[model samples]
Structures are given as structure tokens and as C-alpha cells.
Target: MDRRALPDDDTVATALALALRAPSRGNSQPWRWQITPNSMHLYLDRSRSRPVIAGEERDVLLGCGAVLHHLSVAFAALGWATIVHRMPNPDDDDHLAAVTAVPRRPTNQDIAMSAAITRRRSDRRLYSDWTAPPGYLGLLTERAAALGAMIRLLRDRSGGSRAFEPRPTTQGWAADSAFGSPGPYDLENAAAYWTTSTHSEHAPAGSAAADEIAEPDHADLLLLATPNDDRLAHLRAGEAMSAVLLTATNIGLATCPLSAPLDSADQRLRLRHDALDDTAHPQVILRVGQAPDATDLPPLTPRRSLAEILSPVHA
Candidate 1:
């Protein structure tokens, strides 16, 4: 009898490479994939975590969750099915997802999502004042609802709206500290993106400069929220956010995540009073609209190498 062959390393590498292309907080790419015959493990890279801004392991998990989303879609593209077990062991330091493989056929949504992985980028450009279509909002809401989250649109009303607000509970900051920096703060490897954009001769000065460079003040914004503001909830929110963004990208819409408004305490309070049912924590506020030209800051951050990030303690 002939011996059965195992999955080749090249095949594994290629599949993983495709999955790892998911967009991160600042393209920090703070994740690692370990492939085994039976399963693929998604691990959070400690070096890529941002404890300060994320606060209590939420942001890091959110980043890893994005990778998980990518991996699931990519696996389907490869005709390999995946069952994801998120944070299987609470005691484990960096493990995020355990993806067990199964044989299955791909669906149209899977192929579409996989195809969109590479094209989706966090567009920071201001939109052309075009309103989102009625059904588009419903689609996004349904996507988030699938992940046990909610999507609320913080429309810019006549009296000024503050719906998606973030409260800064961390020390040494007056809320919205992340937004104050004018860059992707706490992003492990955003140096390249930040440094390049900052030093660009074409860059402008101060708040106006960043906005001028980013072409701000034009996109229609939407808020992504969740009940029970916990670390796991935040991770789920991230996954939902990624899914919504991908769907938007597939339809030729420009999207940017603007946590700035939510990152503010005053805004958060005002928003809570206005939007949620007095028991919701806003996770992300994303801007979506039509922009013929979407400008984005360069993602030039240095990330910790895989070796530095992953320590093989498997015995």
C-alpha cells in the first residue's frame, strides 16, 4: 500500500501568507500563524500589542481578530474549511484562535471576501459629501449584528451630534489621547506609516495639516457599538468592523475608522446620552462615503519579526 501524503509546507505557507494580509491597526501586522496538519493556530504577537491605548488587552485582541477574519475567508478560498476557537485557553499568554481544518467547498461570499482582503485599506480621506444608500446601512448593521454587536449611525444633525463616543479611563490622559497625537498611537509598527506621512514634503501643519493631508471633513460617518464593554466584546467588534469594511470595499465605497470622536470623554458622555440605551460602550466610529480620490497616510511602521513575536514552547 502506498503511504498517504501530508499537506506540503509550501501549500501551508501560501495559504497563511494570503491570510496574513489582513489590515491591522496601522499595518503593524501583529499576528502569527502556526500551521499543523489538523489545524492552524492564530497567535497574538506580544510585540505588536498596544496596552496603553487598548487598555486591558482589548485592542490587541481586536487586532488579532482581524487576522482571524482574514484567515477564515482565505481558508474558504483554498477549499479548506476552518472552525475558529477564540482564546481557547484564558491562561495562555498570546494564543488567539485555533483554526481546525475541514474539507469543504467555497461559496460566492467566501470568494468575494477573499478577493477583497488585499484591496481593502483604511481610507483616511474625506468623502465627496455623498450619502450612503439606504440599504447599505442595513447591510452593515446586519453584519455587526451577526457578531452580536450593533451599528448605529451618528448622523451630523442640525444641532451637532455626538453618538459614537469613547471614554478614556486610563491614567495620564484626558480622553481621546489617541486622537490627540495626529497619528496611529499605540500601533506597534506604525513608524513607517507615521514617519513617512509626517516627513512628506507635501504634508501640512498642525491639526489642519493632518486633515489637509488626509482630506478630512467630508465622509459620512457611522458608529459601531456593542453591549457589555469588555475585552472579548471589543474583539468581536473588531471582527464585525473588518467584515463591514470588507463589504464596503467590495462595493467600491471608501471607508475610514474615526475613533477620534469616540475617544473623547465629553463626546462619549454626550453620545451615550443621545445614542445608546444608557448601557452601551462605543467601540469604533467609521466614516463611509463616496470619494473619487481617497487619500491615505503611508503605513511605514516597523513590526516585530515573526521570530521575535513567536516563541515555540510546544513540547
Candidate 2:
């Protein structure tokens, strides 16, 4: 077999470019990548992270996980197999992973998912009515499962997923972390349609909202979870997040990762009883649906430069 595909300088540089496109809170890009002679190191840049609560830093780790997965996918697509050692140093929490790329032929799935890196967009425009075949969602579940995470469909009593639409029967939440305080809203017909509850008061203005007016959504609500709520579990959830999202994008679905409302443990416990019966710790709530007209899709979110996020590995 042909085995000429080692990750040289150009390949590593290209892979890192694609990988850095992974999503993060407020586009914070809370990660640092350092290149070595034979490996790429992933680190959690605490300085770049902006945890809403000092104690709850799952979002930051999850973002790192997404980039980690993206890097792996990028390497695979570039004809190299990735050897990933997650949390390589127990003593150093910042040492997230050490990845080595081995030369090999890429698979069809690898090429497709890698191409999805640039195509993926978190479009927040109002979705028109849509339906995904059971297999489509099942594939997504499999992708998440492959990375030690699970995706639970947040369906109502009728066994159907709920959209980001107001419901008079349920309580509303109106908190935007950027605004520093929870804003006002209509309790009877709240605008924070997708990601909030009575106790959640720190979600962003776009994802959850701090007032009664915001974007309208008719997308499926999916709770992405893992077995434990520790740092590693959150990171795995983020990896699974990248996998599922890329798969969704590859299959013509528009995706959005909502991290709020469930930002608080109280809200998560409430959602636990309301949605899942398992003991999994929820990390991200993904909104999946058909993309709106090309003209209506929101502009892409900006990103950090390669120099800002990448550097040489320190001894």
C-alpha cells in the first residue's frame, strides 16, 4: 500500500488552519496549539477562556475538544492517521492532548468531514418547517457515541423535538451574560425560546436572550451529554460535538450549538428530569434543521489568526 503521507510542515499548517475554525463561546477560541518535530500539542489557554462562572468552566473545555476533533479530522483528510492521547498529563490540567500524525491514505468519510470544516456555519436565521429522516439523526448519534458522548433528542410528550418557539405552559428565561444582569421578558410568552429556564440567567443574548425579542427557530433541540461532568467528559462532549456537527453539515443540515440555559446545574437538573432519564452530564444543546434560503443564511462568524492561536511547543 502507498504510505507516503506524513504530516510535514505544510500539511500541519493546513490542518491547523482548518482545525482552528471549530466553534467557541463568543468566538473566544480558548485554545493554544504548539507544533513539535513529530507531534502537535493541544493546551487549554485559561487566559483566553471567559467562563461565565469561575467555577463552571465546561464551555471552555468543550471548545477545546471541538478544535481537537477538528484537528484530527483535518489530519485524516490530509492523508495522515491521528494518534491522540487525551489528557496526557494528569498533573497538568492545561495539557489537553498530544497528537501525532502518521502517513496513510484517507477514507471517504475523512475527506467528506474535512471538507465540512469550511462549509459548516452556525446559521441562526428562522428555519422553515422541516423533517429529517430517522437515519439522519441516528447517524449523528453514532458519531457522538464514537467519541464517548450521547445525543438526546429533547422531545415533548408526543415524542417529538421542540423548536425554539414560545410556550405558555413552560416558564421563561431572559438572561444575557454579556449584559451582566438578566433582562426583562414576557413570562407568559417568553422570547428565550430554545435555551433557558427559570434559574438560568447567564446565556448569551443570541442563544437565549436577555429580553422578549430575539431570533425565531423551528429546529430540533438535542442535548449532547457524557457519562460524567468532569473536565475530560466535557472535553469529550466537545469532540463529539464537532463530530456530530460536521456530520450534520456534510448531510445538508444547518446546525447551531447552544450552551446556555443549561449553563447552570440547577437548569441542567431540571432539563434532566424533563428530557433525559440517563445519568449523563449534558454539555451542549444543538439545534439542527434544514438550512434556510441561501440568501437568508447569516454571515459567518469571524475567527482568530493562526499566529494568535498557534506556536512552537515549549520544552
Candidate 1 versus the native: TM-score?
A: 0.75
Model 1 per-residue lDDT tens digits across residues 177-253: 34443343322223111212222342334543355444334444577778867767766777887788788877777
- Give the alpha carbon lDDT tens digit for every residue of 1-315 in model 2: 744434678888899989988988767788998877767889998888878677788888988999999999998998988988999998998999999877789999999999999988876544546777669879999999999998888742222544322222222333443344333221111123343342134444454243522433456767788888899998999999999999999998888777755656676776665565646777877777777674455566677888988867557
Top candidate on TM-score is 2
For each predicted model, how many residue pairs clash, with residues at least 3 apart or on different chains? 10, 0
Q: Which one wins on lDDT? A: 2
TM for every model, in the order presented, reads 0.75, 0.82
lDDT of each: 0.60, 0.73
